[model samples]
Target: MTGRGADQRTPALLLAAVLLVGVNLRGAIAAVSPVLPEVRADLGLSPSSVSLVTTLPVLCFAAAAPAAAWFGRRVGARPGISWALLLLAVATVARVLGGPAVLLAGTVAIGLAMTVGNVLLPPVVKAGFGAAAGRVTGLYTAALAAGAALTAALTAPIAGLWGWRVGLAGWALLALAAAVLWRSAAGTADPTGPAPVTPAAAGRGPATGPSVWPHPVAWAVGLLLALQTMLYYAVTTWLPTLLVDRLEAGLPTGAAAASLFQLVGILGALLVPALIGRRRGQVGLGLVVGAGWVVLFAGLLAWPAGWGLWVTVGGLAQGAGVALSFTVIVLRAHDADAARRVSGMAQLVGYGIGATGPLLVGGLYGATGGWAVPLATLAGIGVLYAAVASVAGRPVTVGGPPSVRDGGSAPVGPAPAGGRPATPPGGR
Candidate 1:
């Protein structure tokens, strides 16, 4: 009875750890945005350099994603998470003491650590909460949104009180605390810590399967995820600037608008997967989100003062867009190992592609000296996303589970559904 009780408690604790980890990941990125203006002033960074500061993490996400899968196979997920979280904490804490170069380097470390979390956490969730992926994903992503919102909203004030360095350093504390919590809660040895995948599933190298690359679902999910991430990071990096320059708003109001964008995004990220239970539901929501994107950009330009409501609409749409992308990550893969693979590939390609938004928009700004070009650039991506989602959002399975060859997966073939256990393609 005690053993069973302990078993039951383990999963709850693991979930908590995932939530904490999620919180740390985004705060590291979002906090910097709010404090970026001040950091720019302190460092005397040009607009292009500033764009690079925000762009570095996404680029790291792309570069380091494959490594995350490698680490999960070699070191085990819990240990990888622990070390990554510690790295994030240490890097964030120590980075602020130096010059802009140090700051950029620390962000690189943070991005790498975050990539591990991004790759490993979903599989861990799938292993533990097999019956409740949507709810768990919602909770996890909500924490992600909460972290971004909290940091986005608070960093400005924190910087005002102390300085941008302290505001930047503050996120390190969250990472540090998350590290401690993860150790205490989830650092236990096997059977109690993170659930492990089969030897064939996780241990196989990246080439074991042609499942995801050749499949249409993977491309769609990847495309959608990429575009949404591009939009999210672009706005997170530059939204404040847009509000301030375009609408002639004050800094605080612009910061608040940025904060509000993420805060409402939490709702969309949290609710979409749960509320829209059917697989095809995301497809339908794509149309809605597309329309909302139109409204979000257009409404902001047309009724600039009524920005609050428009912000909410835009936030909800983008949030739901992200939520759907994540859902597709889990839903489109056959198992936890596959989840990690799909996640790695999706984020790798997605973030790699998405990283261009900031530079392009910033270049546009530098060239045109206005927000119109940036706004058009963002809206144009939305238009492109509509076409991709129409296909990626379709009900289809990725190729199949990871082929173990002789000793790995058995009878490797097309996944039953788009990674679902029993459903077939388009079955719902």
Candidate 2:
């Protein structure tokens, strides 16, 4: 292809690669949850052992996030993602080939590989898509939710026909395909050469960027992501059982409700980009998402008959919550390097705190023998999430001087190269 022709095609190819990578990020983990019973029975595993298969990846996400950022810095984001996908495919196959020990080991490998993808993708989107980052982020988040929903829905049927091992291992095909596509799209050139010294990096080398952990704005964004993730996981883990116990629903109905919770989230994910285009201040949007969570939990508490409405609304909120959090991460960072650092720090805090949600909700139900207290606790969390989202949604960049004490708002920092403002005009 001619140089101009290749340049024209690169964006589309990169987008396709990104979507494919997003699909593989959660499918392997989601597949295991649906076939846990078969896995447990066949392997003679205890309940805790079975739980580890699902929980190990989240913990690994936390533990490996910094490593992912480091890997991206060395190999560049595209190569980093491609390498991670290759490992994910191998890990998926390995996890299903043997007994319980092999399974758990494979799970750890899957988590670590996925952590690279999770941490690097936002920076890739920012660097590749530029001003259209929010819309691309929405598409990426939708792909993730769709992959998870499809895997969860299909795995049980596949396991019934074949076995749990085949069902689990089949997702390796997705990872392999993504790896091949990403390799082709990214080409052989490594983009990790020295970045231009912009005003944001004035008086400092490219390698000497500030850490995101010390920034209050980064903390706000991380807390919002953490709460959203925690609530989503906790509710997803228990919503079916909650329906069965509280509303006297049959297993089929409960299962359908759970499916709705996953599927409706796609709409929520798509909604964010449109909202970003129309509105400058995201605090109102954040409030709406927060209200969705509160209404879902409160409605379930007051009248369990409205379970359908609650689940649908909660799914939308959960989907939008994640997309918004990542969009903020992209928009708030002055450049791709900052985006990577902030993304890593945010996800480390996010998954680390979120990994406890299922355990906490289950423990509460076991002790209380009812969903009332647990649901109430989730409602309280929804309130806290709303408060944090307000802070996170502000038009403030990480490392920028704070103009307010409560993390309300701050002026954009120095513009990067090409004189483009770090944040887009009107606070997008």
Q: For candidate 1, lDDT tens digit of each residue in 40-142?
A: 8888888877877767777888888877876775665666888899899888877788887887888898889888998877766665566466567767877
The whole-model lDDT of each prediction reads 0.72, 0.80
What lDDT does candidate 1 reach at residue 51? 72
Clash list (residue pairs), candidate 1: 220-392, 397-418, 404-408, 404-409
RMSD of each: 5.5, 4.6
Clash pairs (backbone) in predicted model 2: none
Q: After superposition, how far is residue 144 of candidate 2 from its true place, in Å?
A: 0.7
Against the true structure, what is each candidate's TM-score?
A: 0.82, 0.89
How much is 307 displaced in model 2, in angstroms? Answer: 0.3
lDDT of 2 by residue, 47-165 (tens): 88988898899999887887787777767676778889989999999998889999999999999999999988887777667777767887888888888988998998988899888
lDDT of candidate model 2 versus the reference: 0.80
